[model samples]
Target: MYCYFDGQFMPISEVSISPMDHGFLYGVGFFETFRTYEGYIIDKELHEERMNRALKDVRISLDYSFDEVERWCRRLNEEEGGRDGYFRWNVYAGEEGIGMAADRYDHPHHLLLRKPLQRTERGTSKRGFILEHRRNTPESSMRHKSFNFLNNVKARQEVTSLATEEGILLNADGFVTEGVTSNIFWVKDCVVYTPSRETGLLEGTLRHRLLQLARQHYEVEVGCYEPSDLLNADEVWVTNAVQELVPLHEIDHVSFLGKEGPVYSDLHEQYTEYVKERVSEQC
Candidate 1:
């Protein structure tokens, strides 16, 4: 496999970082995972903008432009047989450091990794497990895609079933936030609801796009919600860059009406069409 490390393209085996790197030492790094359809990246500009904002927030000094990053992604995708796959862009403090300080670093390291995407049925449904882990406080939340993923990792470990799709996490105050890997959403009485950004959930790219697409068809509400809200929902779904949207058959013991509910079917169909249009424009 080939990856982009720093400014060069090389075999993945050749890429390495210092043991003292602050990202590894203090979790001072952020990453973005995106999907490419036949080498066409979806929402590249939005992903770039989000990453830039994350870098600035953490004081990571990386000067690469989005155009340059996209070019590298295209090249790597072409080299990897031009199939649908996942791309992860990781930026971290490169300087050797031991403390929580960011002022010591002058430049950051950039790593781009790629892997072929596993095919899944578009109508696939998932069963969720309500995890005991609570998301970080709003003030301490790394809402961006950061390397500090121990919370998510721990939550995922609680899911013992292979058939289970994801673990739903709540905030410290017992309000539903998101899944370990995706943003959570539900439809109740024809209204779409998701946890607000104040819940300390990462405002995912696909989540944002879906909200925009949904608002044209239904009333979209974002606020603090409890598990009972999802348990009684007519339809439940999760969204991310790769999964796009997955319907939920049940959450813990609560069974939904069906996997492909009416609203979900409509939104999923529209999202699929939207993806096709975006990919065609890139082509």
Candidate 2:
């Protein structure tokens, strides 16, 4: 497959980087994962804005412009037959001297990965996730989508062993925050609720859109919530750019009838139409 590095497009096999890259050595990098629909990149602007915010938060300088990245992404989508596939954008400090000093010369790298869409269905449609409440400290880059993901990986592995789709993280005070790879949402008495941005959750693009849509149908509130709120929720769901929205039928051992619920069906239908409209713009 063809990939983008620095400013050039080349075969993925020919891509190379230094062994002292900060991303590999100290995990000091920011990245975003998005998918394409037809020839258009989904939520293109929002993803770029978020990546910019992440870069600012981590003090990583992005050497390329957003338009340049967008053009390259669109080209990859069309050339690699990526009608439906994932794309990864990475920016990190380049290899420098061996010490862990914060001072170093940094050169950002960009990679465009193309592959067939992966449709993974785990657990029942009506079943939700059983999260082991563990929160990485604020200093650990939990709020940024950086390359340091060993903590998330370890938690996800534990949840997978227990046969769950995703894991939920809670802050030190025991308030539900977010999932390892997605954002969490729930419906109660026809009102939708999610954790506030102050909870250190990565701002998900799809999560932002769904909240706007939900506001039209019901009251949407962002606040701190405990795990008990999830157990009591009449309906639960998770959202990501690729997954869209999937109903959560259970949390931990608690069973919830989310998939067959009226709220879930209605939102899912609306989300499908939203996608169709965006993808049709490319044609």
Residue 132 lDDT (model 1): 90
The lDDT leader among the candidates is 1
Candidate 1 least-lDDT 10 residues: 136-145
Clashes of 1: 0
lDDT against true structure, model 2 = 0.73
How far off is residue 79 in model 2, in Å? Answer: 4.7
| lDDT (10s digit) by residue, model 2, range 61-128 | 66666657667777777675545567787786666546764644456666666665666662236344
Off by over 4 Å in 2: 65-67, 78-82, 100-106, 120-126, 140-142, 161-164
TM for candidate 1 is 0.94
Compute the lDDT of residue 9 as modeled in candidate 1: 96
lDDT per model, in order?
Answer: 0.84, 0.73
Q: What is the per-residue lDDT of model 1 for residues 136-175, given as tens digits with 9 covering 90 to 100?
A: 8643445777888888888888887534577899989899
| Clash pairs for candidate 1 | none
TM-score of 2: 0.87
Q: Candidate 2, 235: how far from true, in Å?
A: 0.6
